[model samples]
Target: MRLNDCLTPAATAIRRKAASSRELRSNLRASWGDGVAFGGMVGFGETYLAAFVLAAGLGELTAGLVGSVPLIAGGVMQMVSPLLIRRLHSHKRWVVLCALVQAAVFAPLGYAAWQGSISAPAVLILATLYWASGLATGPAWNTWIGTLVPPGVRPRFFALRTRASQAAVFLAFLAGGITLQLAGGGPHLMTAYAALFAIAGGCRLVSAWYLYRHTEPSPMPASMRNISWRELLGQLRSGNGGRLLLYLVAVQAAVQVSGPYFTPFMFRKLELNYGEYVALIGVAYLAKVIALPWWGSMAHKVGAQRLLWIGGAGIAPVAAAWMVSGNLAWLLTVQVLSGVAWAAYELAFFLLFFEAIAPEERTSMLTLYNLINTAAWVAGALGGGAILFLTDASHAGYLIVFAASSFFRALALLLLARLPAIEAEGEEIGLRTLSVRPNAASLDAPVLPSLPSQAE
Candidate 1:
């Protein structure tokens, strides 16, 4: 029978009766395999490239800018994506096009860096292109992901995928670190960095190809009215969404303000060697891989709101731990805890945000979220740079600033307590209530109608 014909009731029933118990496992393996390939390439490539670039005499501010520029550019692009989606009329095509652009941009960046004499203006422009390319892919990719991964089992599936990705990331970091060591910390390092970027770009191309292979079910019909910035603002101002928006803004501001400087601080203040630094970071990523499943389960059980608090409460101590990290051991301990806490925060936040928004509004909602979060990151990065400049990069001063930022994050958690619980599949759920299945149609499922041109 044809593939479509095989999906009929009689065929399904027959398959169910004949199917071995291993079928489910086999399907899961396929999903996770794809996830791993995609995650490994993107995650490792991004981190390895950043570390390599920083080692090539990019000042701390410049290094931080490299990291933040993509976010800043991506955020700005996201603001207009909803409209673009309407005008373009094809999320998949747009995503593929963006991926191609990303590949094109990076090849030149690598070549320029390898040749040396890359001007600051050129670097900034390339960075902007790179960032924009990545950012443009977001809405389409995210929407496509929602279609591919069903809602009811998202937490479990994501947990499995994250573990696979994290494992790859761990190995990638190790290899990248070794490569940097072999290349040494000078012009040759730039060569290695450029090579890594080339490899990364290749991997991204493969990922894009894989994405194109997958089927995206039809989207919900577009709403009659097009979406506008005014409408978006109104949505934020009028409902429970408004309060959540405020809380998100607060959290983003707090985290981003101090987060970007952590690496530079370690390098400058602690004087960690390249291998040692990457290894330390590897420990954190490893911890995250180990802890993600548990956090995913926890988010499924307890509501994301409560998990948010746990994550927030945990951050203060982790930040505090940094102050006393005079050695690798202390830093490793802090890294483990920070990784676990961040996993919880990330999984919970995404789940919560997905649950809170209606299907029709997902793209716009994500766009807004990205925009706000990006702005916060930019503000924080700029602020951190200013602080460092003013203090002449004093370790003590940076530590104090980071500690304060952690406290501010905790305050945002306190604000989360007052936010309403999100209802999933007609049930009011808490962080501890993991058994409740979310709405399949709502969770990343592609059945929902798209917003009209005006709505977009």
Candidate 2:
């Protein structure tokens, strides 16, 4: 009794907090599994796919198409997500099944590579299936996670989750680069790709397992309003929300104009070894890991819109910077700068997209927005491919394409400049203060959305 009486209230408080912490962990346990699963995907995606395709004897056009065609197909595939959700009664079910399919898509590829069956067209077709499965999962999964996390913890939780995923991606990318280089580029390289992709698929299956465990708020909340096509079209025409969506499409179109070609340029033209290529790409991911929070802070200080402008304008010069030098050190510097700008632009875009759309409507809007965004990426890829083709895939051609990409990015910034800034009450929005969702009443936010199109 004497010892208890002597004890500080702070000690009791600490005990209480510890108990609550365990309860919190129980509630969010599924999300933890999901995070681990997503980390696995970092090992292989579009970037690695580019390396694989090129090593398979495909040309620049094939590399560009690797990113482009899948996105184009995925966008079209996503249009059906809402319908699937309607039939399934649970977003988790849809996500889990489709994700398993995505993983399985890799299995056949391994067999094909071993059989000498891998080719540009075969890769494109298989990749299309791979992307279709994953992309379809996104709409359902984003909607599901949005309902899972409470807002008070969303900012920090999402940031931490994203950092973890990015870290995994960085490590995975380093591993892939090493595997490709050590394995050496030749006919045998296809076997290596098959094995790596198979492993990557297994990772996704793990993610699916975690997703299956996640606790989702009832898939259909009470009295929810379903947005119709006419309303969606109207938003595109005069709504502030539509403008935000268009801003993204514009920015991405600008970025992709030269984005997909970087692989071909470096690996084929500059002849950077797999390690060097990985270094260039991996640095950007690392920068993202380090800089995302900084960007979030800047967004807090200045405002998401202002940072977006800075990011938008800042991003425009990055592709052009490559034109100034082919030196690895110089290119590495360019990647670091690009990573910072990417953090700013990407964070701002995520926040802006969520802020402008309503909660119950996110599933529908995101599905549509992603579809359009995917289409824009394809357009950008096609534009880059055309430039390279016209120039005979020459180094000069790449420079010209890079220069054009810069112009388009600047033009996209101008569009952003015309848009209105997001207003906040009592406090400026930072990653800490924000959840990147629609109205919490029924909104969905993608804390760790699979940002596949971003780097690759």
Candidate 3:
């Protein structure tokens, strides 16, 4: 009869539900669904933004810059995330908002396609928004999902989730390529792009829905901590981690030098149609997917440091390999090799870098790394663009940039050599970070801490 008795029942009813077996199972399904839908959005829509730029007559220069330059803005924009997350103290809410914003970015692109053209500036703006929204979600989603997925099963669960997501990415990307090919590769392809963007936007919305369905702990995990630049720099200066980070960033820079321009080269100089272009990209992506498990196993045996040497050596020549001959068969072979090289490089990066971070510091650390990494990316891209601009965007110009990329990649190996040996953990899987790249798929640097090592 007491008021305390009446209030106690209401309080208990409002309490957070225990993560019972059924709830955990449900969360797992929702998380996997989110991966598939997110991958669909990436493949169908995000992957083709540069292609869409070219089709819209935005100029090869613009198309070439599309992939790397905007990432600078996106990187800057994502820096706001850790701050906002600290203020709001809710990773889920921040992540979902970013996802929705990412979905909305497609609308303007689709509208431009409907209008039959878009300016170079407009393409840049839209691309910035897309990257901004997408990048912002990375740090938050990484933290949020760690709490949802139990560490005991984290390795197996994420491995399966990654495979499923990668499959979705490949299938959707292939479908988009086919659709664009069928829609007519020349002037009339705007409608096809528009439709792809629409579907891609819808996929992102569905991804957001599934993200919302995942259970957030009643009070969010207290692992979000601000890592000061001074402290981070001190940490970098004090260990082999700095050399490793330097090497990775340099590799990215070198890769971007040739990376963004490859698509425009395909569309213009090579005169490859949508189908052939898609085939090349798809081959690279499939090869990467297939090679990753092998790379993971190699890491366990030979250690990540050895894996880095293997990957770095292979990757150094990849961009330059394009100059060997532009024959489709040769190109496909190059793609397969490139994919394998990249898979090893990326896995080694995760094992060496992400494994070293404290969970509480991950969000901030990743934010800082994103900025440094993307700066290298933009610088490399701008360097490539300058060469193309100076050479008048000729076929020979593409080769020059490719050679330059290889040169820088080779230089990055010097840094790699200075890297101290890292003992590989015997974990079943490394941390997975989703990144969308043109003409290929591979893991990027981890934007989250390793799950198996999270503080209880």
Among the numbered candidates, top lDDT falls to 3
lDDT, candidate 2, 1-456, per-residue tens:
676577689987887789767655764676766665566664564447776777767888898778665866777778777688779888788888887888788787777766655777788888898778877876666666656665666655665665566556557667777887887866777777877877777777887887777666568655345678788778767766677777878877777778788888887899988888878877766775577667766776887777778778778888889899899899888888887777677677766665655566666676677688778878887888898999999999999988998888888776776777675211112221110100000001244322212111
Model 1 per-residue lDDT tens digits across residues 162-218: 556546555755776777778776668778777767776776677567656655454
User: For all the candidates, what are their Cα RMSDs to the real structure?
Assistant: 7.4, 7.6, 3.3
Task: List TM-score per model, in order.
Answer: 0.79, 0.86, 0.93
lDDT of 3 at 42: 78
What TM-score does structure 1 among the candidates reach?
0.79
Worst 10 residues of 1 by lDDT: 433-442
**Residue ranges of candidate 1 with Cα displaced over 4 Å:** 1-34, 145-159, 216-226, 420-456
| 105-147 per-residue lDDT for model 3 (tens digits) | 9999899998898888888988888888887777778778877
Clashes of 3: 0
Which whole-number lDDT from 0 to 100 does residue 126 have in model 1? 73
Name the 10 consecutive residues with the lowest summed lDDT in model 3. 447-456
Candidate 2: which pairs clash? Answer: 359-443
Better of 1 and 2 by lDDT: 2
Model 3 residue 202 CA deviation in Å: 0.4
Tell me the lDDT of model 3 at 307.
85
